[model samples]
Target: MNNPYNVLCIGVNHVPVRRLSKLDYAEKDAKTVAKYFDTLKDKAHVTLLTGENATRTNVLNWVKQCSNIQGKLTVIIFFAGHGSAEKDENNKKLERCLWINSNLDTGPGSHQLKTSEILNLLNNPLHQLIFLIDACYNFDPKQEVSIQDIFKQFKESERMTGLKQYAIISASAVNQGALEDPQLGHGVLTYYFLQTMAGKYTFFLRRKISFFRFLAVLDKRVRNHRFLTDT
Candidate 1:
């Protein structure tokens, strides 16, 4: 496949000593993504950031630099780490956030990378942009925002042009936990997504896979796993 794109893979396995629990396989997840993309050397430029290096500032800087690229560009960002959803005080809706290295501090002003920040940084003049978030989200019943809804809002926002193609895929649905499998040595969603991308578990569809088709296969594969029932 002639995949012309630039890939940024960020994986966070541990926070600073002050924060919560550690993600045992997040670094592995990032490495796996980088390795997979490495095979597409003919069609892509891949950058991998893991552990302490995957800080908010570094990520933001890279995104800004990529936005300045001259010609047609497709940027794919894959984040594997902790994610949370908090109630938006004004809208009374759940807003998603990604825990970066700096978010480890429990101080009064500590901040994680929220959906809005990401949307702003990535809303550049790129041909296509894709986000794959593999993290557990604290879904609230009162105002849970679906993955589609989040991206839709970005499309409608004044900062972004409606013509740009964008896609955001989450590992799990609202109020669900994105579980990792010891057997597979990876997050269940990531495992399936890679498999589908590599054409491992396709349902005999020999044709080229579309983005939505890949999502459908990934969702089905994840739903069928018996051990991943823990939310």
Candidate 2:
């Protein structure tokens, strides 16, 4: 556990709300994410948080307690759940980062966690942090409550301060859906990332492999997959 880099994979397969639509591939998604870290078990401390039983308390604990204080701590947050966007009174937009146990039917600030709140957790001086979001907001154009609508109201630049060497990598681009497949048992983007990193894929520039190049490999694989559901 003294390796300096600690990777915690939090994959929630269960939602809090009963009778709600469930993710058909949550278990597979969670398992795949865990497996990815299992490969790094020899070099770094790896923790896997999976299943519908995962709670926010455990997540916060892992981030706050398990982080390496002395060395280069690379913390990665991977969520494969629902996400939304909400607006403030001054028409400011905010990214409503939902946990697996989130209650989407509730009013603003009810069951969801703001992206800012999560960012605040990582404000402390750490080695480094990376957030990978595999969730997308469902926007109904006619309702004027588009996901992009809420995000347009706020400036990410301001909120992104104090996050030293932090990078946010999302699964979907602008106005794109986060694709999932039952057969693959994971999100398309995550699956491809694992495949690319399967064999000692370099995570740092010192290894002469940029993250951009790593992603290109994933993008190519996803594009060639005939069963991909994303548009």
Total backbone collisions for each predicted model = 0, 1
Query: Distance from true position, residue 42, model 1, in Å?
Result: 2.7
Alpha carbon lDDT of each predicted model: 0.69, 0.58
User: Which lDDT tens digits does candidate 2 get at residues 1-231?
Assistant: 555456666565556544335666655666677666666566667676666345566666676664425555666666676555544446455445555553235544444556566666665464577666666544334345654554564344221122346766665543445667766667776776676776455553224476666656655676676344433
Candidate 2 segments exceeding 4 Å error: 18-20, 66-68, 88-91, 102-110, 139-164, 199-208, 223-231
Worst lDDT run of 10 residues, candidate 1, spans 154-163
C-alpha RMSD in Å of predicted model 1 compared with the true structure: 5.9
Worst 10 residues of 2 by lDDT: 154-163
Models 1 onward score TM values of: 0.78, 0.74
How many backbone clashes can be found in candidate 2? 1
Instruction: Quote the positional error of residue 45 for candidate 2 in Å.
Output: 1.8
lDDT of 2 at 19: 32
C-alpha lDDT of residue 177 in model 2: 54
